[model samples]
Target: MTSEPAQHPFLKMANVNVALGDRNVLHDINLTIQTGEHVAILGANGCGKSTLIRTMTCELYPAIPGLDQPRPEVSLFGHSRWDLTELRKHFGVVSDSHPGLYSTSRAPDTAGSSTGRTTGLNAVIAGFFSASTLWPNLIVTDEMRQRATEALERIHASHLINHLVGEMSAGEKRRILIARALAHRPQQLLLDEPSNALDLAAQRDLRESLRGLIADGVGLILVTHHLNDIPPEIERVILMQKGRIVADGPREQLLTAPVLSDLLGTEVRIGEQDGWLHSW
Candidate 1:
């Protein structure tokens, strides 16, 4: 009898060793994220959460396990080899620095600063070329514009299309970033510290926007240190400590008071209310 085809996980890193300047940052890491899954990577600062996200997004490569051990593999959609740009088409990434890319006001003396306002539509259109702002040399077609508009519409930000990026609120700007990333119609979205520098109201709006994306069938991988940053849709939780994965399981299994306390290295009380988690 013939055997079935091998299953391909959406994102997989097995026996991964990542180092920076001879100092090992991640050790023997093995993580697998399946299609359509919502997962949150939780940890304090310098716990390797950002490194893990960067590795998953292909911004960093895994190191050889050791001289005696065979080289490990990092796969996206089951393939280890990829043209970076072409591979980016498969998924979109949103990092904390994304908002800065929308900045319009800058001192003339600031090095590498370009001063210009970007409308919501233009912001989304720039994603087609992976540029932070629409530049003179970038070529844009009617279809690309339409796709950008549709992406904004999908995220309920079409109304802000004419608004300049500098004028929008933090929450609105974040939605525009989402629209920009979605313009490519990628299968998955990677978010790093998505709720950073947002007020309570903006955080609520951001969470709602995330729900909209999930409803549209976009898989999400969220990396954040805040408990409330995790939306209700995320089912799995991965905890990191000192550059290693300490726990990986369903949210319910990992978000308990004791576990969270240990993960954060503090004695705290955790409470759940209205599908949101808060700790003190």
Candidate 2:
């Protein structure tokens, strides 16, 4: 009998370099994340964490190979190129900086004129079309609606289904955005600075939701500067500085005060409670 074919990693990069505008954002990067792995990319601001995520999602491309240099390798699920729409089916992305996600427009007469018209449910449904909000021209089937509702329930945000996106609080909006990403049931989720604007209670709630996803076997790739944002379920940590990864190892090995202090460019203190790491 033939052995089963080897599985490709969810994401892989080798000798990768990325540049944006006048600056090089990622340099000679080599990374791999297998299926079902929960990993965190941690770093200070402008360390290229977001740029790396973009590269993985195909929003950015690696630098062209020089005349005499071997080509850089950047692939998702073992494919070097992809149709973006099809790629979204495999990877769901949530980022605060994703444009038009919460764009505001004039609301109807019943709601405040300044509020956004997109309701939480509609926003989630837009995931099927890869659009920020449902457009009149786009077709949304009943099955898609059902999936969106289930996604909200999974994230524990069903109460916000009818709430206008602009009317909900920051935490509530985040849950909706996560649900939007989950609507299609992607194999993995990519979150960029997910807790950026959440309050303490909201942060706790978000962590609980993330833990639920982990328990359900959905993989996560979290990119954040805050140590607290690294969920307990994430076993691996990759620390980045100045556009390069400085350390890649188990969470326990890389989250020490010394490692963090060097990564963050300051003296650091750390503590752990319930498998979550916090720093000051």
On TM-score, the candidate that comes out on top is: 2
| Root-mean-square deviation of every model | 4.2, 3.7
The clash numbers for all candidates, in the given order, read 0, 0
Clashing pairs in 1: none
Model 2 over residues 160-275: C-alpha lDDT tens digits? 88988767888997898789788878788888998988999999999999999999999899999899988888999999999999899999899899988888889999988988
- Highest lDDT: give the candidate number: 2
Q: Candidate 1 clash total? A: 0
Model 1 misplaced stretches (Cα beyond 4 Å): 1-7, 97-115
TM-score of each: 0.89, 0.91
Give lDDT for model 2: 0.82
